[model samples]
Target: MLTHLALKDFAVVQSAELAFGPGLTVISGETGAGKSLLVDALGLLSGLRADSGVVRHGASRAELVAEFSLADAQPATDWLRENALDEDGDDGRHCQVRRVVRADGGSRTWINGRPVTVGQLAELASHLVEIHGQHEHQALLSRPSQLALLDAYARNDAERRAVAEAAGRWSDLLAERERLTAQGDVSDRIGWLEHQHAELERETLDADSLAQLSIDHRRSAHAAGLLEACERAFAVMDGDEGPSITRALRQARDTLQRVAEHEPRLNEVDTMLDNAAIQLDEAAVLLDRIRGDLDLDPQALEALEQRMGRLHELARKHRVTPEQLAAKRDEIATELEALRGADERLQGLDADIAAATRAWQAAAEVLGATRRDAARRLSSDTSALIAELGMGGGAFDVVLEVLETVRPDPQGAERVEFMVAANPGQPPRPLRKVASGGELSRISLAIEVAALGLDAVPTMVFDEVDSGIGGAVADIVGQKLRALGERRQVLCVTHLPQVAAQGHAHYRVSKSASDGVTQSEVQALGAKQRQDELARMLGGVEMTREARAAARRLLSDAG
Candidate 1:
């Protein structure tokens, strides 16, 4: 329920604050007195777009604030908690929304003193208040809205979900079938894949095999140079021919050992010669081993080069490097297997599509039945209300037009349209075609009243919805609004005295020009003040005795 609203430098209102409680609250004023300004303020706080034109002439910005009690608004409370915007006051039964609109047309919103995006604010506001503008009656003309309202009234969430899920399954299967059919024949593609697979399978593409092949190719390419160098080194170092490194080193070591007893320094030289002789012998052995292992066969070299060339060609054909050949081969084999089974899979798809279609039809049937039952009840109830709202002999009907299509529809099997006949013995037509704005307003109200508690919103605001209505009909409208207030907080802006008199709380908006600047003011009225305001509304500029008496009677009867 709305607890308070405050507006600062917004439109023609310089400043104003109003306190609200449970039950019907009405705002009324003379012509051009800015009675709807309060409603506009609430709308801004509800996340409506802002404009620079709404700012007062000299003000830099406009501020709007609204406070609601969450005691009865469990949905809103849960939303705040889930969003981490809840506070620890009143055990989390308090919420405050503030919006600031700058003169440049930019605006910002806050919930519980924490800044938020407009989308977030709108989401939170949905559970707190529902504002029905004077012109929002046109919303009833939309077929989708009519269908949604019926579903809401029927409480058919489970049925709707089932239908939607079944339709999704059917659509997915149909898409798969279409894809398979679009592929035409894959025989040629499959044959190409098999040929490529065979070519890749003949090659050794693993890392170890490629590395060893590279090594053998290098060794064969340098075989002649390696063999010649190894033989010369072995002959010069360890050979028995002429003077050699090993023989010279041994003679130098023996001569140094003989002088070691005479000079200690000569002993170090003898040890160096001995080490050099040992190193030469080890070098000759390694050279001999390498020369024996080297393969000088040209044919073997040619075979390794052929293998490398084939690997390169394959990599180029597949748009991959040699290192990726193994993975690419496996990928081709998998795709080839799948193509070979395409016909079999396509045959399976036909049965799957048929089963999905059956499931969707079954769910749609149940949903359609539920809608029909709800449509009948909603139509009968709204028709009775239309008559009560001074459209006697009027009839309202909910028409479910069966759709003709072979595909599954998520919205069930029918299209819903609201039909109405505003006079007795006349054929009902689409509600959208109703001529009079007054009749449309009344019908909208009638439907809302008929399905009042179906919505979970804690507050409802009606902005001059009683327009084009007066006298006893207006009185009935007022009574209905008051009754609606019994279950939900209602704020109504009206010019009708009959409607004003029904409010448990009343406020009057008045404007005055001060130093060439016009400002609007709002004041909550007491019994005497409320009576006078009603008299003014009833009798216009002059306060007539008869009008005061009528106002008093209206209030007495309303009590």
Candidate 2:
């Protein structure tokens, strides 16, 4: 249950902290007194989006926090445990959710002080609160919500899962069939793939071989210039015309050795000259070997150019680099192989689709019966409740119609709609089309009470659910809400004294503006204070003796 709520600069609330308890807690206030603002703050606990627009004027941001005691909320506790969101070294009996909205339209959320996604917050809150807004009538008018409510009421989760799974398998097979059909003219594609495959398979085109080939091509291209440079060097070193470097070094060594017998320093110089002459001779021999090996064969160069040109052409045709062509060829080959067995696969898919369709039909028939029966009972119970809410002679029906297609749907074989007639002798129409805003609120309240049988949420909030209802009927609505509170927590923001008097605890919300800043405040009322407020609600601007007496009678009867 929601234990405490705190708001900072949220709407015109300024700042407020409220501690709540189990049972029917009623909030009453004049219209525009921000009675529903309390509901809005609680809605934030459900991960509803907020922005600076929801912040009070001149505030930079809005902050909200809610606490829930999970003594009985096992589903929510289980969710926290599964997601690792529970606090350490503590029993999983308490949870705190906080949300902050910045003026720049940014927001942050936290669960137990740990940052969390809004989706996770919303999922956790679903088990904690079920809020019915005055304008959420669209949910009642929607077909999907109707079907979901029926299934939930029927508690046919197993049957529903079976139908959904069967439909999924059937849809998968159909999707595969469509994909193959769209790939038209498989034979042509396969033929092209085969040609490319043969080329790649027949050639050795790995990265290492390609790199070696690049080096060989460059060497062959520059062979003529390289051979000329090497021959000139050899001519200079071997002294083909003048004294070569080797011959000059030899002459220097001979002159130095003649003086070496007289001076030891001269011997060292002669030794260095001898080493230079030997290195020059070795260089000349290397030049001769390189010159002999050099070749500029026109036919061999032409073969290399043709090979490289073919690789480049294929790369361009496939819109890839030369290195990527091999991989792309293999990918196409794999697809082509699959196409070769398309006939066999298509036959298999047909058989699987037929089997899946049969399974779906079987599940749908079983689940559909439960849904229709639940729908009938739901409609009947809801209609009976509305009749007591001052809509005498009103009638409600749950219409189950088959979908337009023959294929099975995850939601079973039919769509459910809520139909109602507001008065006798009138044709039943869509609930929204038949009821005005006031009637819709009463109808929604009835539906909520009936659906509460299936809802496991720990808290239910109704904002002015008693709208456009008064007198004995308002008293009935209050009694029903009080009875619901016995099952779980119930919070209601009401304007009717009849409803207010039935509250296990009463709170009065008042709006005040000071220095052009508006603020709303709520305070728990004492017995005398509640009586005075109920009197004011009963008599409006003036609380006469009769209104006070009526308020007392209401409090007494409610007790």
Candidate 3:
């Protein structure tokens, strides 16, 4: 429920604050007193588009703020939590929405002090408030909105969701089957993929195999250079031709061992020379082994070069690196398998599509049954309400137009249209074509009352919804709104005295001008103030004794 609203530099309203409570709260004022500005502020907070014209004259921007307690608004609380917009300290039991429209036709929105997009604000506000403008009867003319109202009245969320899901699955299966059929025969494509996969499979494309192949290729290409280096190294280290390293080391060790008897330091030198000789001998043996392993075979080298050339050519052809050939082969093989089994899959899809169609029809039938039941009850109740609201012989009807198509439909198998006959002995026609603006308002109010505010939105604002009625009918409108307030918070903007007198709380919007600057102010009236306001509404510019007495009678009767 909306607990508070504040406006600053908004149209003729400059800095105004209003607190609201449950039950019917009425806002009344003389002509051009800005009575509807409060409703406009709420619309902006509900994420309506804002322009510079809404800002007060000479003001830089217009600000609108609304606070709602989420105690009874579970959907709103869950939305806030899901969007991470809920405040911390209050356990998300309160929500504050603020919007500012700049003079340059720019606007910004915030929820709980965090900046948000207008779309997000609108989505959250849908669970918090529902506004019915004076012209909202136009919405009743929309077929989808009408269907939504019927479904809401039925309270069949699960059933509607089931129908939508089944329809979606059916549609998807049909699209898949169409695509497969459109492809005609894919044998040629399948043949191409099979050949590509076979060609790739002929090569060793694994990472380890490719790496070893590269190493062997490099070694084979340089085998001549390696053999020359190994033979030269072997002769220089251990060749017996002249003054070899091994011969020199042995001579040095023998001289050092003889001198070790005179000085112990000579013994250390002797041991070092002996270790050096052993290391040189081992290195020479390794060099001989490497020389034997080296092969200068040109044929082996040419084979490696040809293999590498083929890998590169394949990489370019496939638009991939040589290392990716194995993955590419697997991908082609999978696709080939799918294409080979295309005929079988198409047959399977036909069966699946047929089954899905049956499922959707079944779900839609169940939903349609629920709607038919709800529509009957709603039509009966609305007809009674229409008669009570001064349309004595008026008749209301809900016509379900059942569609005779085999295709799955998310909205069920039928559409709803409200029918009405505003006069006795007249044939019923579509509400959109037969009802005038005022009659539409009354009928709209009747439907809402009959539905008993079944929607989950906690707040319902009616802006001048009672515009075209007076006298007893106006009184009945007020009573009906008050009755609705018993279940949902209702805010009414009206100029009728009878409607003003029916409020649990009353507010008067008065306009004042100074220095050619006009401003509107909203005041929550006390008991005496309310009476005076009602009296003024009853008697015009001046309050009369008779009007005051009548106002008192109204209050007494309402009590």
Among the numbered candidates, top lDDT falls to 3
User: Each candidate: what lDDT?
Assistant: 0.87, 0.84, 0.88
Output the better candidate (1/2) by lDDT. 1
- 498-537, model 1: which lDDT tens digit per residue? 9999999999999999999989999999999999999999
lDDT of 3 by residue, 1-559 (tens): 9999999999999899999999999999989999989988888888777899999999999999999999989999999999999999899899999999999999999999999999999889888887776543344666776888899999889999999999999999988888889989898898888888988988999999889989989989999889877877777776644568888888888878877899999888887888888788788778788788779999999999999998988899999999999999899988988888889999999899989999998999899999999999999999999998888899999999999888999988999999999879999998778546667777877888998887778898888877777899889998999898998898989998888888999999999998899999999999999999989988987889999999998887877
**Cα error of candidate 3 at position 263, Å:** 9.4
RMSD of 2: 8.2
What's the lDDT for candidate 3? 0.88
Q: Give the per-residue Cα lDDT of candidate 3 at 294.
A: 78
Candidate 2: residue 553 lDDT (0-100): 91
**Tens digit per residue, CA lDDT, model 2, 448-559:** 7777735567877888788777878998999988877887788999999989988999888899999998898888899999999999998997999999998999999999
TM-score of each: 0.72, 0.65, 0.83
Q: Candidate 1 at residue 42, lDDT?
A: 79
Selected candidate, larger lDDT, 2 vs 3? 3
Q: Write out the backbone clash pairs for model 2.
A: none
Off by over 4 Å in 2: 44-53, 69-94, 102-108, 111-128, 136-142, 172-348, 425-427, 432-435, 526-528, 539-552
- Winner on lDDT (1 vs 3): 3
Could you tell me how far off, in angstroms, the CA of residue 240 lies in candidate 1 after the best superposition?
A: 9.7
